[model samples]
Target: MTRKLEGQITIITGGARGIGRGIAKRLAADGAQVIIWDIRPEYFDSVAAGFEPIDTMAVDVADPESVATAAQTVLTTYGAPSIVVNNAGINGPVVPVTDYDFETWRRVIQVNLDSVFLVSRAFVPAMVEKSYGRIVTVASIAGKEGVPGIAAYASAKAGAIGFTKSLAKELVTSGVTVNAVAPVMVETELLEQMTAEHIAASKAKIPMQRLLGIEELAAVVAFAASPECSCTTGFVFDASGGRATY
Candidate 1:
């Protein structure tokens, strides 16, 4: 590896497993010091053993207080992070809007959408002070093209994309770049939350007729978080396997 991100400090929310784990490992390998913030830290030891050592903190990203506390810890322990990946999210029940539970819809939006706002608000000022940062949100293709049976998840992701655009513009002249990565179905434990039919339908929408690879998504995110990605901000990088156009 070229170590393009050498000495950079990075934070990845929901990095205990799945897509978040993949991105964390990739960033660490590229020489960034990675810290994981997940609601569950019991699995951190096992996951960290498989790759380079990564610091872990138990955090409920959806909680404003929790994000604030964790952000302070990161700032004190690792100094200001040059990279922040807002990847914590959930797939709400596979039910139609008419059948979806109102509370569950709210929960999904809080976790997937509000967490982004809270976490970014907590750390962005430090980045602005230093005049350098990379903020990447893991959105979904469903956000761009709504999918049936996952209204809550899709709506939250759409909010994420919108947030990315808005923040990018706000920091356009501050040496901080904000962007998003929209991927189609990926082979992650989150898939277990969806029905088999839903999974199949998502994969079929991709021209590749396959789910995305964890490392593949990590590679794209690594680029977006790197110093080389200087000219693009507020852009949604696609990892949809040809499923997204426009």
Candidate 2:
């Protein structure tokens, strides 16, 4: 069988584990040279061993300098990537906007929103020069509908959706496509970190009454990253398992 991503170079942020890791594995399996960027370097040994000379880099995506440095390193090693998955994110504290800590909100916005800007700023020129690229940002249902307690997370994801649409418009003439995938809730390690009450409440909101699987979401990521995604720019693909009505 022919690989869908043959000869494509892909970069995935927050790729050490969870949703990002799932995307990295899926893209690699589909024949893209995958770069896994995350803050943890220890998981690199195990994760890297699973693919063909998988590359790993440690960077906090929220920092512009860090993102630029990592992008440079990846470019030097693998040339300009044709595909990028802006998947790095943080689920900030569960609190109402008024009760939320300012510092925590800033951190969440920095990671989830600023990181996309930093990554796009650092790498989009190359994509433009090459005259071809695909960018898929991992957004969330919180972006579309306001969640009760995850104010920071919801705000940041909404920002990501806005950024994705804006960038898609800017790159419309070029042979580059930009889109975002918004998933409701996935059964990932990040969800485990949430308080049991928060998790229960989140599950209760989903019509499916269960968390989505990593592979299920990866399928959406894979499609948005495909070359066949010619006419679908500046769009949001909802994988909410019936949680999204709009």
Q: Count the backbone clashes (under 3 Å) in each candidate.
A: 0, 0
Winner by lDDT: 1
Q: RMSD for all candidates, in order, please.
A: 1.2, 1.5
Clashing pairs in 2: none
- Against the reference, the lDDT scores of all candidates come to 0.91, 0.88
For each candidate, give its TM-score against the true structure: 0.97, 0.95
In Å, residue 197's CA in model 2 sits off its true spot by: 2.2
Worst 10 residues of 1 by lDDT: 45-54
Candidate 2 per-residue lDDT over residues 121-163, each given as its tens digit? 7889999999999999999999999788998899999999999
Model 1 CA deviation exceeding 4 Å by range: 46-49
Cα-based lDDT at residue 136, candidate 2? 96
Global fold similarity of model 2 (TM-score): 0.95
> What shift in Å separates residue 76 of candidate 2 from its native position after superposition?
2.4
